[model samples]
Target: MPLKLQSTFPALSLFGVLATLLSLPGLFGCQFPPKIDHGRYTKLFSIFSTEYKYECDSGYTLVGEEKISCSDSVWSPAAPQCKALCRTPEIANGKLSVYKIHYIEPETVTVQCNTGYGVVGSERITCLENRTWYPEVPKCERKILAGCEQVLAGKHLMQCLPGSQDVKLALEVYKLSLEIDVLELERNKEKAFQEP
Candidate 1:
């Protein structure tokens, strides 16, 4: 009887352990992981509390809030509005050229030329949604007519003589005087030659 009781005891213990395990919900029925509530900003697993943020695409400007929130499982305040970026005047050879511009939108690249240089074509440009800008870059050129006044100043006296004195009469008088001097020298030379 003792030997039989010992064998039966082992079997009974095994049966009890199996019965306890089988009775659990995981064993008897399908057990699932806990479900998260998406209601009223509740439990957004991958996101943070209330606020969500998004960045605008290149060449686009954000017109509304950069951040949005979730409430009752729905996005709050809607997605931010986007607009096409405005342009700004461009500059070329900034070291030598000059330009002026106003930026109409954000993220627009503005360039300018240095002073004493002028630009050609449209100076203002903008980056578009297509990732491009219009009007391209302008060229820079040096300013013309640097020392014209100095040249004029040098010729001022020459011009004043024409107005003050009769040019034709003065020229004739000067020629006659030269002729007289030449005749005198020739006469002297002839007299010397004849005497010798």
Candidate 2:
């Protein structure tokens, strides 16, 4: 009986060691998927039925599945791809002054209003990671000169002078009204600049 017990003890130890070795791979989460370029996994070691979150690089948007799971020794939903997109935004009543024609991610462009117009929003816009412009596109609006219409209307109330003098006086009034309008426009612009 003592001899039989000694023989069974060694066999039981060997069986226990074999069982631990066989289960180590699954227990320690050693199985991992392949490395992805421009992407990252949620965990270093991917275990069976483990779901991993993937992220793409800046300026590149994810085109396929965002999360993938490891099942049956294979990555489900396959691998996602990072796609590059260059989108140019349209500015209303203005045009974009870009260094390059193609507007890729992180690219910046200046918005300039047309003549006789002023910008109401941001002067510059940046391309975001999602292939869209940040802060949206700015718009240009027509600038109104303060008291310009009133000055023009006051011209009709003035007394009429004689012959050529009347024509000269009218021209002079028109010129003075134009100057006033220009000065008022400048003052308004300066006020806008000082505020904010």
Candidate 3:
């Protein structure tokens, strides 16, 4: 009876291929995940690479792709940045002249209405630090200038107050202002005396 020895070349060859493929990444200098300021990413595993889904914190806006791929242990493209900005404002029947995913704080946007519609509120709105829009969102009110419906319906588009009423209201306002001024003067005098 003759004993035969089996060569492990086939198994060893497969192992060598895997080892070289895995070591190639290290040889080329594998990269760690890049740190994204004001943002975070979640790791997703893949067969030959890694993926990350990024998200900006509250009050921060992401400026790049939400998902990024890392092939051969190096991230593709550049990491996204999180910017402190206000979310886009939604205005019914109107649109902003310059639309963006987010707006810088204190920035102003122009509002435009569709055809046959008229702007009913501020034509321009400013973004605030608190992410709220100043002067509120505008609306596109259907134009009624072709007819007298708005005026007849007393929509207040045209003023029709009597002269007597206007004078009376003005006098009342003047009296209130005078009283306030007197009170303020008296308070200032008292404060001066106390300071001395």
TM-score of each: 0.32, 0.36, 0.36
Best by lDDT: 3
User: After superposition, which runs of candidate 3 have C-alpha atoms over 4 Å from their true positions?
Assistant: 1-57, 61-83, 146-196
Query: Where is the poorest 10-residue window by lDDT in model 1?
Result: 33-42
Q: What is the lDDT of residue 196 in candidate 1?
A: 50
Model 3 lDDT per residue over 1-196, tens place = 2333235666778877866564443443556557787789876644345567789888877777787765655767678877668778777777899999889767899999988789888999998756788888888888876545634454341244467677567557756866897999999999999995
Better of 1 and 2 by lDDT: 2
Ranking by lDDT: 3, 2, 1
Q: Model 2, 120-180: lDDT tens per residue?
A: 8788888765677777778899776885666545455444555777767777887897799
Error of 1 at 116 (Å): 2.5
Q: Which stretches of candidate 1 lie over 4 Å from their true place?
A: 1-53, 56-63, 70-75, 81-92, 95-112, 146-196
- How does model 2 score by TM-score? 0.36
Angstrom error of the Cα, residue 18, model 2: value is 27
Colliding residue pairs in candidate 2: none
Question: What RMSD does model 2 have?
Answer: 15.3
